[model samples]
Target: MIESARNLDALKRRLASLDRVVRTRHAHFPFGHAPLDRMLGGGLARGRVHEFFACEGGEAAATGLSLILARLAGPQATTLWLRPSAAARQGVPYGPGLTALGVDPAHLLIGVMQDEGMLLRAAVEALRSPALGALLLEIRGRAPQLDLTASRRLTLAAEQSGVTALLLRLDADPTASAADTRWRVGAAPSVPLPGNAPGMSAFDLTLLRHRGGRDGVAWRLIWDNERGLFGDGRDERDDHGRQGEGREGGAPLSRASLSFPAVRPAADRAA
Candidate 1:
């Protein structure tokens, strides 16, 4: 059994190496924020997996970030989201919720897997599929199947298929991962509104790990779901729908507002 395991490990390493050498046209998935893009060395590279973790009471924030990225796949593109059966029992993604989050329900397919192993398997297969524009896997806690080796396998599949993969790790501590970037997300206090109404959701994001990039940088960002973009409370659009260029006093200055630029799907780009 030991020898067989060793052989399998070696085979996986070889496959990973081979996958790295396969030449494919990779495009940048920019966050539309100048400072964040600069920190990311332009932007998150496609054909790679990004890992996101949430602190206590921040599950919604982390999922929001992932969904924002998934929206970058464009309206016509297909996105696959996988979650464990346990998570499905508590919070299954529905069309209304996703629509409220600025994601088109028709473009997303949600899968509830029986266990971590099945979830990872489905994620890997979806990552390898050329038809999918993006893949998202959400896990609530630590799972043995999500170790470094398994992560590398998923990474290799993503690279080969040129599909973007996002892993949302909820209520978990940081650990070794093969993902290109890792972020820790926490809910931030929202701005107060008139009539004691609730304001937009905000998130405090920390760059925990990034391949070939600096870490420890943090930002408090607000998501404009209606616009399908992120904003830093700089200014509001005028009545004509044009955003004004001005910073708020005593407000945290966001480097730049993110604009949802059109990024063609991988197959379309390859064509």
Candidate 2:
């Protein structure tokens, strides 16, 4: 009887493991941007470390990138935002916007490192913890080539422990390591929004890279700081937009034409 009971327990454990694998395979962030979410193969998974390497030349792009991190952190989940103090204080006042989105401000653990090594190490360790829902590493400029092995280990750790880490950095850095998804963001001044007043905060959000697809598809969005929400941008020239996704007259929103808007300054631009 005891042997049978032990076997049953093992079987239950196995089933649980299998269930997790199935779920992790389709990890995603529900950012309310269907087009953007669809492009990400259903958005970023919880157990995987997805890095965003930001490219140069655009506030629309940069702001959109910050929103991506904020979205992954979710409305109310524990987050560990690791970066330098100066970055946390001056360059980006990102936490307030996150709180505005409904996240528990107190639950956030903003860690500042004296050196790069400590920062990366803390990042690796943080992902290993079960309490954290997401780990965000904001890089202001180029991604330095510190230790590939270490980076790989961190990636493996995230996968093993079922935690998500986002290595957010600039695009100009040619030496950055390969990531699950690579994006080049830029601000397109002319991008339009779908609803409300035309001039209400907005940006040109481009999806520069997907795991397995062509690049250069993007979205234009209207960002309203007063109300922390993003909506589609309606441009007449952008005949295919969120407005006309299905109906005959509806503009067919392309991966390129649609915009993903976000409220201003998640903290300040890191550099």
Candidate 3:
């Protein structure tokens, strides 16, 4: 009888260890930005809900940044983006533009809901799918349906499924929610390329709230589409006025530079 009891305890311990390993694997992934990752306690947490609010005239920037993050979160997994039908007025996603941003259009699925209620319902349901890599819910204006209770529900589903949830809010103010992190995203001038060409996409990001870390920090990030990563928006130039190796903590842009074309997806321009 003592031998059997010992064996049972060993099994229990083994199971517990396995659980820990699984949780660790799904904990978080590095944002590739040194300072930002350090501030986030290693990286952005997976299997949790995060909120991104768009500043004035920055709806496109917020959407673009969120999509980039979703791709990073689950590069091999499919991402489903849910939006209300009314959002069609802003503009639908453009395929070429998405490709230029380093996100493969083939792995993305767009779902247009009839109203906010249906959109939230679909978001919760999508969060329950373990196969899904990331889920993005684009809510415009005041979203009453996404209350504290609804956010909690989404969080629970994400925990069970190990999927990251990104909420993009346009024309809305921050409200109470169970989000792990809240950010305000706006467009920033990009570095001009040779021959006065438009450079990569840039964003001015502000961390409004972080659940277990510091907040009210800001960072300027430049998206490197070719590498599918983000830089510190400090692009170095060589002697010939060509681009050089980029490093963090470089000098900020001195003058107004070009930004991404306004014809991209989720942009303010009419489709």
Please name the candidate that would achieve the greatest TM-score relative to the true structure: 3
How do the residues 160-224 of candidate 1 rate in per-residue lDDT, one tens digit apiece?
Answer: 88888999998788789899999887766655546765566566778888898887667666666
lDDT of 2 by residue, 1-271 (tens): 0011012234233223321212234466544455556656766556665655554555335645554455454434455667654454444434444444334455455566655666676777766665666777756654463445766877787887777777766534534443555554455343344663234434455554455754455555544344444554442112223444443366464333323333334443323
Error of 1 at 90 (Å): 1.2
Judged by lDDT against the true structure, how good is candidate 3? Answer: 0.73
- Candidate 1 regions off by >4 Å? 1-26, 192-197, 232-271
- lDDT winner between 1 and 2, please give it: 1
Of the pair 2 and 3, which is ahead by lDDT? 3
TM agreement with the true structure for every prediction = 0.74, 0.63, 0.80
Which one is best on lDDT?
3
Question: Mind giving the per-residue lDDT tens digits that candidate 3 earns over 75-185?
Answer: 866677877876755576766667777777767766677778877877777776666678888899899888999999999998887889999999999999999999998
- Cα RMSD of all models vs. native, in order, equals 11.6, 11.1, 12.2
Each model's lDDT: 0.66, 0.51, 0.73
In model 3, the runs with Cα more than 4 Å from the true position are: 1-26, 232-271
| Count of clashes in candidate 3 | 0
Query: Which scores greater on lDDT, model 1 or model 3?
Result: 3
